[model samples]
Target: MNITFFIKEFHLRHPVIKEIKSALIKRGVNLDFVVLKETILDLQSLGHLKFASNSDLVVFKTTKYFAEHLAILMEDEGLRVINGSKSIRLNRDKILNNITLRKSGIKTPKTITFHSSEIKKISQKMFPMVIKPVVGGRARDVKLVSNKSELEKNEKNDDIVIGQKYIENDGLDRKLYVVDDKVFGIFKPSVLTPSDNSNAFKEFKVEEDLKEIALKCGEITNSKIYGVDVVLGEDGPYVIETNDFPGFRGIKNAGKIIADFLYFKKNEKR
Candidate 1:
């Protein structure tokens, strides 16, 4: 099998990438490493390099702006794209993710999206909410505002953020990873909580219920390979967000699972 792997320099250091690359090669798969952003050239230019045409599939991992559109272009050219461009575009917007998930009967946190101009629409019920940029990853710029003062303090002029009712958990959360028919997850501490309960991750098992929710998330996002972050609330697990390219840092055998699926299982007839 031949696959075109899209990765940028910013993500070049992730250990999982190295592991996946090595594992895929061992399985008799050929990989063409391409920097999606660097491949652009004018048709009028003397030297115009073409995207690899012999690739069986394009396995993209970067969240770089405009990269998804490029992937879409390749898909339009008859190349199979893993975790399709539509899924990546949906993952880029948290507001869209929340709305679509809810409409699909998948439970997510009560959320609202607003910009600085629409700040007056924020209600008292939304107080003590968690706020984050509509497009971001790794929890960067995420904040929990328990009061009006905090909300105002964190608010920036013309800023747009997705505010969701903070689901209270005892620092227990799950990151569910999906690769084709393989769905598994990890229980870990919430990054938003005040406590460092990372040590308790080992105690959490991959429950059947969690797998069901994770698979539902994949269906909702139309992504065969993705991640769903679930916050275990008093009622049950409420999906926090879904990732187009989830970093499976400590999850057991994640690299092998993803690599093997792309190399072989995805094309297998059920």
Candidate 2:
């Protein structure tokens, strides 16, 4: 079977790109790289191409807006898209996903989603608040707001916002990759402080109970390839967020596991 991999740009040097290519090759499955930069100006355009192109499966190391758009387009084409558009959209938006999880009886932080005008009301509810973009990703604009003044300052920016009471915990954030209802790997996100601007997160061994949360989250998102980030709170484990396409780092046998899944699925059709 032919699997098409989507990327922002085509490069032989990137480790993730190379890893996907090499792993697929070893299993004797046909792989092709589709670079968004070469063919389209934006995600919408790139998405159109994926719908037109032929492939048995499409996989991504991480989720992006364009990747999400592509999934929707593929759905229109009647192609079976992995991590379909709806799932990606939910996972990328902290406010929406948090609301959904809470409604579903899943544990999430107490959140208040609102327009910028609602900051005054939000400030009244709690202090030592955390503020982040409702739709932002890669933790690009995550911030901690200590009080009303800080929240008001951020309000000037007219973007959808998710405000929540910051849970002060010493526990590290965990990353869990669930493939087809099974825990493929677990990782601990590298520590970050206010002073550190670096986006890198580290991986560690899977916690005993964390796997259960990950699997439950996977079922909630309804995506085959998804990642869940959770933190240990005073009450118990609380899910911070869910990712549609989780990045694989420092996970043993990740590439092989993913490649094997593809290999087996391809042969099963024939």
Candidate 3:
């Protein structure tokens, strides 16, 4: 079986990547890498991807923009992409992710999305609100709106942003990493604060309720790999967001688990 990792950069320097590569090699699976930077600007490269590779699976660790586009192109050529094309598209947009999850009976924060043009019509909902780019990830362009001046200053005509009711949890965020059926949590503290951009990660053991929420979320997104962002509110755990790609730092054995799953599926297909 051949597995291709299409990423912005190789995780070769990372121990996790090494472990995954070693595991796949042991299973006689061929592992390959393609730099997304080399393809995003060259439509010709993407157009010829299917004709170029006879790989069994494509694993996307690239930009959501490229991932969504390549997913369709790859699938049209009768190739399977992990996490699926539709799921990738949904996960890329926070508005869509929130709507899909809520519609699936999964709980998420109250959100309102608007093009930068519609900011004038947006009446203030509450302070301590969150402004998130609909097409943003890794907390890029995410801001906390504490007052009118900050909200007014946040307007950007080019991008759409989601105004969400901020859920609080002692200045920390719970990120649950899901690989297929398994779920693990990482407690990232002050990562959202503008002062500390670094992720101070600590292992968070998944409780039964958190696991349930994560599974329900995965089912809705059709996600084989996922990260569900949940906050502990006064009532209980509230899932505010989800991501297709999250740094799986605390999940030991993650590489082996993913490797085994791929090999098992490849064998089943054969």
Candidate 4:
């Protein structure tokens, strides 16, 4: 079987990808990589894109806009893409993700989204909120504001922002990485706190409830491979975010699990 990975150059150096590549090679699966940043797409005609038509599956690993458009084109042409183009686009927006999760009867933090210009009108009662960009990752531009003054002082250049009620937690992040039917949990330091690499990324057994939430996320997004960021608040578990093709940083044997899932999926119909 032939498989193509649509990813950025930096992904080639990722440990999970490296292991997956090695395992798949040993399995004699033909592999191809297309660096999203460097690959050019001819929009004039779908017939010009021979690679899309030739591959059995495309593992979309990047979130670039151009890559998304290309994935859509491939899907339209009857090619299969993991975490499909619609899923990629939905997971990229924090507002939509939150709403979708809530509407689907999943628990999430109470969030209010608004334009940066309307920041001044925000009530002081909404203090002690976690604010972040509508489209962001890796905790970049994420802020914890305790008061209106702090909120006003936050970086305001973003076109949109989401303010979520801060859930009281033990300061450790509970990250659930999902690969097909399996869900792996890890305890890591909160990005808001100082990094402690020594104590980070220790894998642990996931509770059934958390597992259900993780799998439900996959169903909601129509994604086979994804990650859910949940915080164990004083009340209960609340999903903070979901990511498509997340870097499976802490899961044990993640590469083997993911590769096996892909191989099984490739041959499931046959």
- Highest TM-score against the true fold, candidate: 4
Displacement of the residue 26 alpha carbon in candidate 4, Å: 0.8
Query: Tens digit of lDDT per residue, candidate 1, span 185-247?
Result: 676766677566656555345688888888887888878888888888889889888888687
Residue-pair clashes per prediction, in order, are: 0, 3, 0, 0
TM-score per candidate: 0.90, 0.81, 0.87, 0.93
Per-residue alpha-carbon lDDT of candidate 4 for residues 1-270, written as tens digits (9 for 90 to 100) = 888888889989999999999888888899999777754656776442467678778888877647667778878877877868877886888888899989998899888987767877877667688988888877887888887767767746757789988888877788899988999998888876546556567898999999999999899988899889998887899999898888889787889889988877776653
lDDT per residue (tens digit) for residues 29-102 in model 3? 98887666653446766543753268788777654446777777887887767767777888887888889988
lDDT of each: 0.77, 0.67, 0.76, 0.83
Q: For candidate 2, list the clashing residue pairs, or say none.
A: 188-204, 190-201, 190-202
Clashing pairs in 1: none
TM-score-based ranking: 4, 1, 3, 2
* lDDT by residue for model 2 (1-270), tens: 688766566344556446657888876777876665543445445544644467777665435536776777777876666677778777877776897788777887778776777767664657776677877655667677778887777668777777777776653555777766557444354333332323235545566677777877777776777777676678987787887756566666665666677666645542
Better of 1 and 4 by TM-score: 4
Candidate 2 residues lying further than 4 Å off, grouped into runs, are 10-14, 38-53, 60-62, 184-203, 268-270
Candidate achieving the largest lDDT: 4
Order of quality (lDDT): 4, 1, 3, 2
Candidate 2: C-alpha RMSD after superposition: 4.0
